[model samples]
Target: MDQPVYSAAAPRILIVDSSRNNLAVLARRLGAEGYRVMVAETATTALGELQRVPVDLLIADLALPLMSGTELTRVVRRELAWRDLPVILISGRSEADGVVRALAAGADDVVVKPFHFEVLTARIARLLERSTRVRQLAADNATLDERVVRRAIELGEARDRLKALEAELGRVG
Candidate 1:
C-alpha cells in the first residue's frame, strides 16, 4: 500500500514487541507511512533506547518478556520528561479489565490484534496532533510569563523614578 509522505524530519516511533513477525510488520507499515521506526524486543530494551534517543511515540505489545506493556507505560508516565509522551498498547486480548489497566497505566490508546492498518494510523495521527497542540500551548505560556516579568520590572523602575522626583521637588520648594 502507498503511504502518505511526511516531511524530511519524520516523527520517530519506538515499537516494542517480543514477536519478531509483529515487529517486522509494524516496522514496514510505520516506515512506509513516513515515520522513523525503532524496534525493541522487550520493554527493558525499549527503555534503554528511550534513554539514548528521543521518540515521539511508543507502540508496545501487552505481553513482553521481562516487563509488560502496562508496566512500561507506568514507568514512562512517571518520568517528568516523558510524562506527555503518547503511548499505544496493542494486545490480542480484548478484555475489559486489561483495557482499564492499560489506560490506568497511562496508555493513550489501545488496539486489539487483527486491527486494520487504517485505524491504527488514524489513531496515531490524532495522538501526534494532540501532543503538538499541548507543546505549543506550553511554549506560549512560557513566553507570556517572561513578558509579564519584564513589564513588572519596568513598572518598578518607573515608580522609583517618580519617588525621586517628588523628593527633589520638596527640597527645591
Candidate 2:
C-alpha cells in the first residue's frame, strides 16, 4: 500500500444504491464525516450526477437497477479513463464472482454487504487522498514539462545565435 493520505480539502463522494434507506444513511453519515455527499438511486441517475458534478470518489452497490455497479464502473472507466477517479463496489455476501469481475472492470475496492461503516469511511478517505495526490502530481508534472520546453526553446535560440557569431568571427579572422 503506497498509503496516500491527508488532503487539503474535504472530498465529494457519490453514492449509488438502489435502496433509498441505504442511500439516505450513507449520505447522512458521509456528510457528517466532513465530505460532500451525493446520492443516486440508480446507475443512470448516478451517471447524470457524475456528468454534472466533480466527484472525488464513488461508492456504488453491485446490484443496481437496470445497470449493475460493475457495468457502471466499466462505463465510468471508459469515459473518464484519463482521470484518477476511485470506485468502490458494494456487493452482496454471495457475489464473490461479481466482486472479482467488478475489480477487473476498474473498481478500486469492494465491500461485502453488512460492512462496518468505519471500514467504508477508511477506504473512502484513503482513495480520496490518493486521488488528490495524483492530481497534484499531474499538475506539477505539467508545469515542469512546460518549463523544460521553454528552456529547450531558449537553448535552441542561443545555439543559433552562437553559430552566427562563430561564422562572423571566421569571416573576420
Candidate 3:
C-alpha cells in the first residue's frame, strides 16, 4: 500500500475570526498551501470543531465575538488531550501588555494583525513539527513503560518457580 503524502495531506487547522472576510482570506491562504482550514467565527464554535475533529494547529483572533482567544488557548492548554496542542494567536492590539499577556497565557506565538502570510505559514510548520516530535517521544515512553512492567512480571514468576524448586529439594532431603 502507498503511504499517505504528508505534504499533500492537508494539515488541519482551526481558525477563529469574527469577520467572515478575514476568515475567508485566511482559509484561502492556508488552503492554497495544502492546509485543510476549518473556520469558526466564535469561541463556542471553535470548541465544537475541536470535539468533532482533531486539529494540527489553532490560529485564533484574540478579539473573538463572545470569548477572547486567550481564554480559548487556556482551555486547550488545560485540557488533558489538547494541552500540548500548538496555538498561534492574532490580535490588532499590539500593546506590550497585550502581547505579554497572550504569551503568558500559553499561546505558542502571538501575531499582530496585518501580518505576512509566509511568516504565519512558517510558524505553523515549526509548531506542527515540534508537536509531532513530542508525540513521538510520548509514544516511545509508553512503550518503554510497558516493557518494564512485562519484565518485572516475568522476573516475579521466575523467582516463584525457583522457590518451588528449592522447596521440593528440601522435601527430598
Candidate 4:
C-alpha cells in the first residue's frame, strides 16, 4: 500500500519487541511507509537509543523481556523531553484489561497482535499529526509571550514620559 510522504525530513519511529520476527516485519513495513525506523530487542536498549537519537514516536510490545511496555510508557511520560512523545503498545494478549492498563500507563494507543498493517499506519499518521499541531501551538505561544513583554515595556515608558510632561507643565504654569 502506498503511504503519504511526509515533509522534507521523514518522521523517525522506534519499535521495541523481543521477537525477532516481529521486529523484522515491522521494521520493513514502517520503512516502506517512509519512516526512519529503529528497532530494539529490549526496553533497556530502546531507552538507550532514545537518549542518543530523537524519535518522533514509539511502538513497543507489551511483553518485553525485562520491563513491561506499560512501565516503559510511564518512564517515557515522566521524562520532560519525551513527555509529549506518542507511544503505541502492541500486545499479543487480546484481553481488554491489558489495553486499559496500557492506556492508563500513558500509552497513546494499543494494537492487538495480528493487526492489519494499514490500521497501524493510519494510527501512526494520526498521532504524528497531533504531535505536529502541539509543537506548532507551543511555538506560537512563545512568540505571543515575547510580544506581550515588549508591549508592557513600551507602555511603562510611555507612562513615565506622561508623568514627566505633567511635572513640567506644573512648573511652567
Candidate 1, residues 89-152, lDDT tens digits: the string is: 9988788898899999999999998899999999999999999999899999999999999999
Per-residue lDDT for 145 in model 2? 100
Which should have the higher TM-score, number 2 or number 3?
3
Candidates sorted by TM-score, descending order? 1, 3, 4, 2
Clashing pairs in 2: none
Candidate 3 Cα misplacement greater than 4 A, ranges: 1-8
Model 4, runs deviating above 4 Å: 1-8
Q: Which tens-of-lDDT digit does each residue in 36-105 have in candidate 2?
A: 7789999999999998988889999999989999999999998854246899999977577888999999
**What do the candidate models score in CA lDDT, each in turn?**
0.94, 0.88, 0.89, 0.95
Model 2 lDDT-worst window of ten? 1-10
Candidate 4 lDDT (Cα, 0 to 1): 0.95
Lowest summed-lDDT stretch of 10 residues in model 4?
Answer: 1-10
Weakest ten-residue segment in model 1 by summed lDDT: 1-10
| Candidate 1 runs further than 4 Å off | 1-7
Q: Could you report the Cα RMSD, in angstroms, for every candidate shown?
A: 1.9, 5.4, 4.0, 2.5
How many pairs of residues collide in model 1?
0
lDDT of 4 by residue, 1-173 (tens): 66546555899999999999999999988988889899999999999999999999999999998799999999999999999999999999799999999999999999998899999999999999999999999999999999999999999999999999999999999
Backbone clashes counted, model 2: 0
TM-score of 3: 0.92
